[model samples]
Every structure is written in structure tokens, then in C-alpha cells.
Target: MRSPTPPDEPRFVLAARHMVETGQWLLPHRGSELYAEKPPTFMWIQAGTYKLLGSWNLSFLLPSLLAALLTLWLTWDMARRLWNPRVARYAVLALFVTLQFGLMAKRAQIDMVLVGMTTLALWGLVRHLLLGPSWGALALAAFAAGVGTVTKGVGFLPLLMLVPWVIWRWRHPQAAGPGRSWKWWLLLPAFLAGTAVWLAPLGIALLQNPDPALQSYAKELLFKQTGTRYANAWHHHQPFWYYLQVMFTLWVPGSLLFPWLVPAWWRRCRRADPRYLLLLGWALLVLVFFSASPGKREVYILPMLPALAVAAAPLLPGLLRRTGVRWVLMLYALLLSLATLVVGYGAVHGDGWAQRNAVKRAIDPWVLPQVGWWLIGFAVATLLVIAVLRLRRAGLAVVLTTVLLWCMYGLGAMPALDPYSSASRVMDQVRERIGPDAELGMVAWREQNLLQTWPQATDFGFKRPVAGQWEDAARWVAQAPERRWLFVLDKVMSPCADRSQVIDIGSANRNNWQLLPGTALQADCVARTHGVVDDADAALQDDGD
Candidate 1:
């Protein structure tokens, strides 16, 4: 709870909270505006957790953790089925220690859950296509893919696994195939059934209510967020080789083995090993599929990790004994420890680099130095473990070092960084300056601002333009000038707002905020009323009902 919620994390949790509060689960809202950027399957799980536990702090992140564990379990079981128990263990360990996969599992992000569903889908396909022609497994896999699609819009990526499966099955005619061509058609209904969990409810709700805004929300969610996003992404544009960089860095020690694994995989694939042909082939397809897209993110290809692990699992026993691989593991751990120590030294001494970082991150002067000491101590401990264990046990040392690093950061640094990153400290200042009785209105706010002060604060609108929000916010303050205040981003404060009358609320989440009293509104200054919508009034009306 103390750790900062990434910008998207708060947006998702807030939408889920709204779902629970309004008893309207079909459509999710982000501060009165429809949050149609994503389908609501993931939020349904989050909101379900909130309803069951009645604790946002505990419930919001549980889904990601569970999904991560599910991914590991599927990886382990699939490897065991394909090879042996030893390979299974290696595959799970390889995935668990992966920098990106482990990090996602620890957060409240949708990607991890989507990865879990996709991995499940892949696992079922492996069982049905590679191992046998089990209609039940194929159906289940299709359903999982459908569920995954609604979860993140790319869930159907697993269905692409069939492309490689068909080729491999054709090449090796004696192996299990998709089985009896007609049986494949039955899987469509299963996929629809999974999608219906969300779409079906949504269809019924729209029929019953039929609001134009809701209809627009449905269109944007179904079409733009999926097809348009893939066809022409507006942001996060990168070159084709972006994911290649991601694999090399973010995949870490496991990725370090790629040089050797590549040739070994080629040899096995050439020899027509079904396990390698299916797993490796599907993994390659995933990589190519994502790389072909214009929009790229490190997490977008996360589902491919399980396939990579399983493909590499059989060779791990031999790969681990290689002196070159062991040395790489040992050196990587040592360099990581040294880097932490050096950073800690700089932070503790209050060097220019450290101070600049602290300033940008809005970290407290005292907090950085305190976090520094912990990092220094942890790094020292890591060094001792590395020295004692040495190269022969390099794998163990690296795993231990990685685990310790996460523990130190999660247990020590996250809480210390939370106040600034989560905007709680700024919100605290707002509360202290105005006292509990004052009404707070938000303008040009981010998710954390509203999430931190929800029900206590009224947001103009998340999707509305800044000018429109400002106009609404100004009007709102005019009604109760004495008791009402506007908490606004520094960049968005109107030109007419009297600076002398505003209280600087300090920085949080890399943005400046100020507590603006209604008296700060200049007498001659007119609110930018163009393109304004009275969403604040509509949201208030909904709340009243």
C-alpha cells in the first residue's frame, strides 16, 4: 500500500472503485469520464477483489500477484510435460528471475494478468496440438484466448500459436494434430463464451440504457483501442529493433544465455524435435508479431517469456555447467551490486547527481540518504554472498542476489519513496492548509491526485480538455468561495489566477501543485469557457442518486 501506484495503476483501481461504488460494473469511469481505453475484464477482477475484501490496499494488487504465480505454475507444468522435472524446475527459475517478468508480477498492472491468460492459452494449445488431439484442451485454450482478448485486446495472440502448430504437424505427420478438421469449428463458441463474460453484460446494459455517451464509449473501446491502436499507434513509437534491446536488457541473466541457446535451438529444430519446433516456433512468431507493430513497449511481449523458458529448459542442465555461462552469471551479479553501492555512496554524500535526481523525483532530502544507507548495507551483504559462493555456485549466488535486491527495494525504498511518488504528501499539505472542512476541487489533475483524495475532492473531468475543466472548476469555486479551494497542476493554473493568493503545495509525482483559494480568481479574468462540458454537474447528479 505504501509503494507508489504507477500512473496506470491508480487509473485502473479508481475505475474499479467507481464500479463498486455505483453498482454499475458494465462500464468503468475515471472521475466521471468514461474510461474506455481498456475493456473492463481486468477491472472486473480488481473490483471483485475490492468487493470481497473491502480493502483497496490489500485487494487491488492481489490479482497481479496471483496471475504471476499462475504463469510460473503453467510454465513449470508445461516444461515437466514436455521434458522432465529437472527441466520444469529450471524453466520456472529462469522465468522467476527474469527482471521484467518478476517486476510485473509485483505490480498492479494489467499486463501480468494478460500474460497469465495467454500463457494458459498457450499451455492448452500445447497439450492439444503437440501432445494429442484433445478437443477439450483446444476448447479451453480458445476460451482462455477469448478471456485474454477482453483483458488486454491482444489476448488472441495465443491463437497464432496454431500457425506454427499446423506447419510442424504437417512436417511430422506421425505427431498429434489439431485433429478432425470439423472439431476446430466448435472452438469458436468457446472463444465467444469467454468474450461474452464482458461483452454480453455490456450489450444488455447498452440496450437497457442506450445513452449516446455510453454508445460512444462502447465504440471507442471496441474499435479504436484495439484496431486503430495496432494499426497506427499515436505514441511510444519505436524502431523495429526496440524489442531486441528489451530482450537483451530486460530479460537479464536468462537472456544472457541467448547466444548459446540460439544455435542449440537451431540444431534441435533442424532435427525435427516436436517440443522445440512448437515452443521455439511459437516464441519466434510472437516476437515477429510484436516487432511488426509500430507501437512497442517492453511489456507487450511478456507472454513470450514462458515459451522461451520452456524451449530452453531441456538444454539448461548442460548450459548451466558451461564455464562461460557461470562466469556471466557471477559477473552480472557483481556488477549489479557494485552499481547499487556506487549509487548509494553518491546519494549518502548528497552529491550533485544525487541531489538533481532527488529534486526531479520530489524525494525528501532525509528520505534519499536513509534509502542510501539501506542500499549500501544490502550491497555489502550481496558482495559477501558472492565472494563466499564464488563461480561454482554462481547461479545460486545470482538468484539470491536478485531476490535480496527486490526485498531491499520493496521493503526499504518503496515506503520511503511512496509519499512523493503517490502525491500523498502534496495532498497532505492541501488538507493541512485548508483543514478537513474545506471542499477541494481538482483541475488538470492526474489519477493519483483524485485517488488520494477521492470522495473528499471533486474532479472536473479526466478526459475533458484543460480549458473546459478549468472553466468548470472556476465555476465550482465561485459557488462556495470561502470553503472551496482548487488543487491544480502548476502548468495548468489559469493565467488569471492571482499567484499571491495561491499557496504553493510543493511537488509530487514530478509535477508541481498549488492550493488556490477562490479569492485568487482575478476580478477581470474570464474563465476559458470554450468547448466546456458541465461534467462536474453530471457526475454530482449521479453521485446524488
Candidate 2:
């Protein structure tokens, strides 16, 4: 079985799959305009992979893995240039084990690719700062910025790191090479070229079509989405301190080190250490930028995590030796071990314990057999922590614990959680019941659901005639000559109460759905209009009788 599709994965996968299947280079989602939202670089990459692998799941996940590997390698290379070999290795491990980075890397999302591109851009800029401005490094930095801008609007945000770089360079004019003449300005054109390669064609096409929908899409993507998000946001609106809350949870054990590391790094920043200043500036700029936005998500600040890891690498040896830090590590390990034991007990005892525990209640009863393996994995992690604590190997303890937890999550928890998290199972049911070629429609269901589940169905794009009502869908089906199926929330089935015409197939993702025979829809229409019949016509019929 395919692993479950996460929240937005289906959208990206279906959009790219459509492009490949229909030979439409533009992304045409059900609700959104063609080519609306972020540029399709990530989707295009997924489409290329799907062509090669013939597996949607593999194609969706491959880019994230590749981007993660690239980020890790780039982090190590950059660390080595700034510090020693030991620090470089630590930087790589720290980045790989960071909870947010690890989780983001395993999913099919544009965020990881955006993070990778921006990291590359930062690396190029840093190289120029350290080794003097070279044509190749400047060009690479500019190109990465442009490509990133197209990937996600925030991709170019990392280019702000150059401000600190320039200030530092000017302060130490000896470090600023004479080559920094007009050549430095070439970066802007390089950025424009990278973005134009993707946007120019689409812009020309939009000019030719000029459909209101297309124009609205371009306007929304280019202006409204960003402006509305920053001002009076439409979604995910939170206080300005939202990222501050996310940092505590998302960064995990890596963030545990931040309390001690940030202060020391701040001291270095004051001393004008160019390396510290560059990394500090990058992380702060990203954090403040996202924090200032009215709309926020935890993953928006992912680009900063690698910079934080690199900034902390030099301090690891010293921090690891602190007694206070070791105590904190031990406490964290102990809490994790206890949590694992509780899960094991719940898994073994079933619903009795699950009734009392919120975490255990969420696990599907069928997956309890896998709980033994999870216990064993957590046991090994706990033992490693004890051994490392005794041996005073703090770095080893952190790395091994992170690896064990990551493995348990990937191998154990993910499989158990798949049914609850992904729509793949629901999609499978649809395929089995309707057959691949059957036309299907959606009523108040997300566009992602229909496209991901039944991409082959011809009736995929029927819009609701009225908001929050299935009457439009009923009317559409009534007018059609062939039978049709609709996926809708179970709560919305009141309008289709007549069981004879609307046959309930089954329910998935907490939504009820049914197949509507075109012939029976006329009856449903009459049933819905029962209260509107004229009383005079009924009296005339009685007089005739």
C-alpha cells in the first residue's frame, strides 16, 4: 500500500500528475486558477520523477529527500570552511537530527526545496565573504536567489544576509576585494534571469488568454496572497509571537541547546566575528520577517534551522561538557522513555488504557501488533542515553537518541498513523467501488481529495452552484444523462435522504458519500420541492375525483 498523503501533498501531486497526463504545462487545480499559487518548479520536478518511476508516492517524496541531502552536505561543507573538521561533522549531525528538518525532509513539500535553495544561496554568499568576491560565487548566489524567488516568494529573503556581509566587508576594507566594482550589481540581473525562465512564458500565455480567471490568478498570486497574508490575513492568522511558540516545539533537542548557545553567539556577534554575524543575521532576518507577518505557519521559518545548527556547531564541545546541560539531556531522555513505556502498556492492554490516555486513544487498534517493536526501539534509545551519560559523551547521546526517535517515528508511528493522516486509503476505496473510469463529482470536499483519489474521473471539476449546499450538485447530476457519484461530508446528506435513488457507498475521512443515478435525480428534485406544491391544484384534483 502507498504511504498516506499528508495535508497538501495531494494538491501538489495531482497538479503535477494533471500536467503530465493532459500536456498542460500550467497547473489547473479544481478551485484555484491555472498556475495560481507558488511557481511550479517543485511540481515539475515531481512530474519528471513520476515519468521515470511510475509511482506517485515515490515521485512525491524523492525531491524532499534530495533537498535534505543537499542541505546536509552544504551545511557540512560550509562549516568546514569556517571552522575545523570536527565542527563540520557536528554541524552535519546536528542538522540531520534536528526534529523539524528531519520531519520536513521526509514529506513531499515545497518548503524543503525552498530551504535547500536558500541554503545554497547563503553558502555562495558566505564563500564570497570569506574568500573575496569571485564571479562564480556571486553568480551562483544571484542565481539561487532568483530560483528561490520563483520556488516560493520568501526564497529571496535569504539574500538579506548580504546586507550584513557588505557591512562587514566595508568595515574591513582589506577583506573586500577590488573586484567588487560594478560586478557586484550583476547579481540582480542574474536573479531576474532565473525567475524569468519560469515566469516569462506563463506571462505571455496569460497575455494571450486574458481570461478573468487567469488574470485574477496572476493578481492573487503576485499581489493579493502576500499582501493579504501580511496585512489582514485570511488563513493561519496568529499573534506576532507565533514563531516564538513554534521554535520551542519544532526545534526540540536542538533548541534545548539554544538557550546556552544564543547568549554565547550574541557575544561573538558583538565582537564582529564575520561568520557569526552572517549566520546570526540570516536566522534573525528570517525569524523577524515571518514573525512580522500576520499569517504564520511553523514550517515557514525552516530555512533558519540549518543556520542555527551551523552557528551552534563550534559551541557543541564546550556546551556538552557542562553539568547543567547533561542534566537537562538526562531529564529529556527519561521523559521519552516513560512515554514509550506508557504507549507499550496501552498497546498491550488495548482500549482500557487507551480510554484514559489521549495519545494511546489516537492509535488504531489494528496496529497494536507493531507496539512491541516501538518499545524495543525506545528501550535501545534509553539504554544509549544511560551509556552516553556514564561515558560523558553528550554529542553521541544526542545524535543516537535523535536517530532512534526518527526511526521509530518513520517505521513504527507513521505506519500506524497512516490511516488517520493520509487520504490514500479513502482513494483506494473509491477506485474499488466506482472503477477507475467512472465519473465522480465533489460537494463541499477539498479539491485535493477528488484529484488525488480519482484523477481519471471526467466529472472532477463541477463547481458548487450555491455555497455550502449540495443542491447545485444535485441539479447538475439531474441534468446529466449518465449516472454519477459524489463525495460529500456525511452531515450534508439530509438533502439526499431518499435511499432508493442515492445509494450510500461508504464513508471515509469522516465524510459520507453516495452514488446518484441520473434517472432518480428527478425524483430527488420533486422530494426536495414537496413543500412548494400548490394547494389549489390539489383541491381541483379532489373536485375532479
Against the true structure, whose TM-score is highest?
Answer: 1
Candidate 1 wrong stretches, greater than 4 Å:
1-4, 522-524, 528-545
- Cα lDDT tens digits, model 1, 1-545, are 47337557888888898988889888888887888888888888999998899988888889999999999999999999888898999899889888998889878888999999999998999898777678898899999999998899999988988887778767777765555578888679999998998989889888998799989999998998888877898667889999999999999989999999999999998998888887888888888888887988889999999999999888888987999999999999999899889888888988757678898977878887888887898899899999999988988887898889888877887777888878888888888898888899998777888888845489888766676777777778888888989998776667778888878888886778888897777523545444333433332221100
Output candidate 2 Cα RMSD. 7.7
lDDT of 2 at 507: 45
lDDT of 2 by residue, 305-346 (tens): 888888889998888889888777666666666777776666
Task: Estimate the TM-score of every prediction.
Answer: 0.95, 0.87
- Please list the residue runs of candidate 2 whose C-alpha ends up more than 4 Å from where it truly belongs after superposition: 31-35, 176-179, 352-364, 371-376, 379-381, 388-391, 431-438, 451-455, 458-472, 479-482, 494-520, 523-545
Clashes of each: 0, 1
Prediction 2 TM-score vs. true: 0.87
Looking at model 1, residue 145 earns an lDDT score of 94
Candidate models: Cα lDDT each: 0.84, 0.70
